[model samples]
Target: MPSPSLPPELLLLVVEAVLPPNPYQLLPASHISTRTLLALTRVSRATHAQATRLLRQRCAFVDSSRRLADLLLCMPRLVPGLPPVLSLRHLTALYIAPFGASLDDLPTAVWVRELFCEVCETLRRLVVQMPFGSLDPLDDHLSVRRTLRDGFEQLHRLEEFVCVGEYPALSVPDGHTDVWRLWPELKRLVLFGVPMDSHWLWWDIATLPRLEHVVLARPVRLDAVNIKDEYFHKLPREDVRLSRDIKVVLMDLVYDLGVVRTERWKEIDPEEKMTVEVFEVPLPFYGDETPLELVTEWARRGALDGSVWKLDATKVRQEEGSDG
Candidate 1:
């Protein structure tokens, strides 16, 4: 007998305890070490089944293109118009950044985008990072973002979202209704790969009363005026009452920028500057591990409240002290 000869039920509990509690981390092949994975798989059929359930619930693999294709192949028999065999209703977290830098991999990109959209209805935590070198043809870039926007538009259940991609001009045309409803359930949003011209999201993001934690990436752009808005959110004064008490986290700050330049981001709202916190990590990948850990804590648990999340997008906030 093995050690104390524990029962199967107890053994299953032990296995689960050793595993990552986050459902998305249940990937046996990836998250689990080779030896641990083998040991878990060898335990018994029931243990295997449990492991399989975890895999089905969350796919937190770093390389998404290959695994997603494999998953697509496994989804029932080449059906026509049938709802997927794996709708992933129980999925809670996902991490998908580009695996490589190649404009030719547009097909894989499309597939990954589609796959994420399909499961958006239930996912609570999501991270999508676009490769800096991936945007070549303008059409493909715009099209993918549009698809992503549409996908996000319907996600009333998502809690935490991390998007690192080309978000230069998410311009809201004057008469478009129902724009802010895109992220009603969102609590924490971490953005990387922020475009130089991307000032549009600041107003929308800060005003989201439901939002608690916001993180943004500041590329090492030091032309002073050139990177004026990097890792910055300018909350208009008039609409400040409608906003929640949000804490801002700045990841990967470009060190040489100096305190004088950094303080200028607060000109929009100096008091709002108090809400900001900076995490000093060496950039390029922000060490990769830290971001995921932060995301996990952010996405792990949060009670959603309908009343506090109320937003009246119709009444736009004109910039305070503006000459216009």
Candidate 2:
């Protein structure tokens, strides 16, 4: 007699193992094809349920105003809404950005806020690159920032949160970020296409005990610096603490027509336990054909060999104690 067929769950697990690239990345390398998923769903009612669950757990989209609007309208038909409300329960990651131009209105849309609210609990990683040249009014920008903070503050276990593009809502006149308080459990944070000198955020970042990597790219002067947190910023008169897990990547934004290649990348330094990939070319949110110098250029001339700067927190602590 022929052997019995395996369980649908087991088969689906096998399929997952065979195609492990994150669906949210939607990279060409991803092996999760629509045809395969369709076959899996048709295998059996059990397979349909499990496959459907997996399908809705990750979201990837090209950041175009039209696409975003269409996606918001289509999400309901695809993902099961969370209880007592309308939201996706299993979604954990999202990557979306406006291609060439910024749709300032898109960030403030009701659907956008609702979507963020819906994924607040389950979202572990988020990438929204509107990067700069936003046309939204200042009030709209502030509103969007507040909404983001509201949504992000609810996320207790979020690990990676990236917000890039024109005047990141996080920026305010006072030099304090609006979202720093919201990221208690975050491990990696990248703020590109903006000015960094004003908002150091050293205190807020170091406090996150789990934080391991940070990438800051300021566009104003095209300044980039990297530092290991074994010694954090010990400003002369502040109570500086220690967070040994930091590895930073810094770069500048430049509009160089001579620069090309979406694949142009650099992993400047590599130590026993630390590595930082400083992009020679920042990923373009617009389609590849768009020739815009909107990236945070690795503006400086150097090997970027992790010898940028250093801060000694251990000595500062000792000095602070002695100041008494």
Candidate 3:
């Protein structure tokens, strides 16, 4: 006897019930049949409306060719209709990489707000990787500021933000300050390859209500003394609320881990609740030592508070070793 054929409605219900919210995984279901998959767009106006929501939930954009057109072409079809089918009610995560300044063409502020509204409403994680050239210092500052302001205005639900990029021409005067003031839900932040005084840039970090993990990689030229003095003199002496949820990691591209670890972070924020961890591996080379030590220390410290800090030294080495 053959298995009885189920009704399309029943199949649709089953598929909708089991479809993981991730877009990468959603592709496999397409193999069952285009009709069955597209049926997702018909289950309800809500699901049809949320097709892009499902797509952006787990999107990845890579720009290996260094060409904006090539990178845009490489985007998966799942993201093609993302701008249209997305809903501001159900978005949770977003990863974006724009090469050759393709993002400059779009109205940065408007686009960012639209995208943010769609994702940050229920978002927990955000990862952004764009080439430095995409941002213009004089011409794009206002737009960038507007974009950031609009994007973060309503993102009270965010937990983590990971940004990786070379030195962009754009500037965010007290940008970190604004982020802390606005995103009360933020908990973890990771930055890579930014050319700024990390210590000065992060002076207002003590204000974050729930920030627990911070990772800085390949900071160009950070001054330990300035950082130490600023934290020691400028920061509050004792804020039980502020001290309990802050941890820091600094990685330099041109120093030894042992040397960087000895920097006077304690002088900067002497609150016994705050812990600073520094690791500097030799430039252009990586060993098991740095990652193992960093992870071990992070786990040891974070475990005490039921949190975790992660550093991927191999990935950092690969990125630095590659010739751009």
- Clash totals for all candidate models: 0, 11, 2
Alpha carbon lDDT of each predicted model:
0.48, 0.47, 0.48
Candidate 1 Cα errors over 4 Å, as ranges: 1-5, 20-30, 33-45, 56-59, 62-64, 75-89, 136-154, 164-181, 193-199, 219-243, 257-274, 282-324
What does candidate 1's lDDT look like per residue over 90-138, in tens digits? 4556655545664346556566656656666767776655453455335
Task: Write one digit per residue (lDDT tens) for candidate 2, span 4-25.
Answer: 9887668768657534453334
Candidate 2, overall lDDT?
0.47
TM-score, one value per model:
0.61, 0.61, 0.56
The lDDT, on a scale of 0 to 1, for candidate 3 is 0.48
Would you list the rank order by lDDT, best first?
3, 1, 2
Error of 2 at 301 (Å): 24
Alpha-carbon RMSD, candidate 3: 10.1
